[model samples]
Target: MTAVLDEAIKKASITWVSVGDGPAYALWCMPVESSLIVVTGPGEQHAPGLTSAPTATVRLRGDHGGLIVTAEATVTRLDHAGEEWAEIAPQLAGKRLNASGPAAEVVARWAATGCAIVRLTPAEGTPVTAPHLPDDSAAAPPRETPARVETRRPFRLHRVRPPRT
Candidate 1:
């Protein structure tokens, strides 16, 4: 297995892609032994009771059995102290996460919005990783070089207001 796959399996944290009323948002998810923690922003969309917590429909990409946790869940805010620690720790641990204060606040603010914390237990076989590159053999036909295509675009930005309250 490649280092990426190995790390993915070992990583306690995974990216959480939340699909909601508006555009999708991706958060960093830290999976503890049985539960997960995330960092998000402070807004009605993310607020508890008002905003919906994302499902644990994680798509693991790996060589071994990638763990797909299919189960009901609850959401909660990690205390301030815990959130602070999670910010700096996840990076040092070499997991996928965005550790900004705004992101962490989203998880911490869950209580104010009355969002429930959930625990996910896998009910089915988790998806596993497969090799992305094909295996090479000594008997394989000789290969030829291919031409390259290059394109470039200047940076641009288009900003719009968030949806109505």
Candidate 2:
């Protein structure tokens, strides 16, 4: 299944939420890094409130004649404890790729605000993609790769607060 996730990741749009000072923003890569995923729509949800991180879980599927893939993703804003936004601003533009459309727009916006792209760190028991199942075996399930969100040290735009009042 890991291979499927990898393939999905390749087709997956890296998305992240920016939370802290102002209104939260949900930005997705739109097929994420490669050519846009045609036909399907972007499964973005409503925005997040202040002091909360907006999250988006996207399902990516790729079909090339016979191959099919499916993956689930949850993107969140990393809350840095007492870290100033300025420190992470510079890294945002660095992650921008030359691709156009939504991703380019997100990068442009992040670049403008000096916001960095947050990496998606899969949590324990998170789902990952793997190689496709054998076409002949209708009863067999698709294989999964051994991939997990090791650890994510995402740059944040706001300071993390202690327990809320």
Candidate 3:
């Protein structure tokens, strides 16, 4: 299933839902080994609160269909040096937009701003489930700001029916 998920996320953004961060999708995600890796912060396109999450739901959507992978997220400081990070650094850095020079150099500059690389693995002891989240692919993440606090609106359904022959 991870193999199937890998191919999907590689083709489309993952709808990531984590506590406090609401939900956000990313176009800058990569499947590293058996796990999926994503980098997000002020300059990136995904949720920054992923760093504070221990568990989150990751959804992959594409022409091949979609799958929901409940994952345990581990936050790693990309600025640090480690053997595991070393091996994947190139792959991560190469995905950085407009990155110049080698991966090592790009990583240094990328991580210099307190950014992080998040490694997500399928949650242990939990079987992969059917899509547990409704499709929000067309909606933006909800802002929790005070100005938006009074904007709660109930959901309404717009039913469509084909004309009877």
Candidate 4:
């Protein structure tokens, strides 16, 4: 792995991943060995098509919170019963923030819910890095969701009264 890629992966707790032609989804990840591990499912972070897609584009942000590197990565879904999962699941659980339960319970829940644990391995090629980065900000409109902000009149501290009637 290139030094820049290694540094970026090691430092980033989250990354934006695009599978196939789908919209990029921000996902929390843990760097395990030379690959990044991401969990996605019903209750976990949504990464549409990541488990099924063979390849994905991963963008990592630098300390300044700007895109630093973009690379093509091969996606591999780890089997829940496999040895790799046995070793990595606990680590991922520990890294997971605000988990609903203990690490073991979290892992069990993931297994029971058929959550996907995917490893993103950077493909062999020159990643798009600084100085060669795209000029466009690549911003896109937010996706439609059921969530909405409630609109209400502002709270007032004082109100006009009829001259102490």
Candidate 5:
């Protein structure tokens, strides 16, 4: 089970996660051991209403209208310096975009402002293969030879001759 999730996370850099009743939102994620670590809030990426949620729906590839995994969220609020912070800060830093300067400094800044590191531990049940997938029979009847809507172009076309040397 762990092996399966590990492989999937390694392949997909992003996960569409929905916390509480909030909408599913995409977040850049990294797999750590059996859990997924995602950083968000303030100056960093934003996924609102996560901190308050108990569980979340994490779509492997944003649902082709189906597949997803439900997980329990473990929120860790990092302090400026500590043994745990020492280890995790570098890994988190490695995943962040356009982060400059030393590792400690970057983490320090993150601590200064409030940033929540979320650990999503996959739930015990089987990965959810959502019910109700669309089939050919369910598709809307052929659009009666397809309707075309005329659209206006923003710019007018013009021909210009080049100057001769």
Candidate 6:
């Protein structure tokens, strides 16, 4: 199961994570050693309650885009001034697409803004996989946000014509 979990994490570009019973959030993750790294804060992705939570449930997708595995992970926040950050931050920045600037600059900005770099280490146990998976699709309604389309409908191009004789 460990091998399977590791391979899934490596192949996955994004993973769904839910802390406690909160809604799962899709976060861009990088497989670092045996753990997955995710960044969240003002300028990065927003994963509410993740930084404060000690454990989280992670769902990885397979090649067919279905849920492949679900595992419980131990969460650890990296200290920006620590050596772990010194080594991992650059790698994460490089993997980050559409970064505002170079890797070094991006790392600097994240540190300055106090972004949370979270590492999720999959716990050793029997992960939910294969035939044991749920039968129904776990789809949920979209969360409400302030951003929405408020524009009126567009005008018709052609005018209505009178009935033909």
Tens-place lDDT per residue, model 2, 1-165, is 355555655654433233343332334443333222211112223334412334323334455423343233344343333242234423333343543445446434544543433334333344434444444522234334465446878888998889978
lDDT of 4 by residue, 45-144 (tens): 9998899999999999999999989999999999999999999999999988999889999999999999999999999785889899999998999888
Alpha-carbon shift of residue 45 in model 5 (angstroms)? 0.8
**Residue lDDT tens for model 1, 41-80:** 4432242231244434433423343433222234444343
Off by over 4 Å in 3: 1-17, 64-79, 100-102, 125-165
Error of 5 at 131 (Å): 7.9
lDDT of 2 at 93: 30
lDDT of 3: 0.59
Model 6, stretches more than 4 Å misplaced?
160-165
lDDT of 6 by residue, 35-144 (tens): 89999998999999999999999999988999989999999999988999999999999999999999999999999998989999988894788888898889999889
Give Cα distance to truth, residue 71, candidate 4, Å: 0.3
CA shift at 52, candidate 6, in angstroms? Answer: 0.9
lDDT of 3 by residue, 31-148 (tens): 7655667776655555756776776666555565444444444444444466766677678888767767788887776567666677766555443444654455446656665555
In model 5, what is the error at residue 73, expressed in angstroms? 5.1
TM per candidate: 0.33, 0.32, 0.60, 0.91, 0.65, 0.92
Instruction: Choose 1 or 4, whichever is better by lDDT.
Output: 4
| Per-candidate clashes, comma-separated | 13, 16, 0, 0, 0, 0
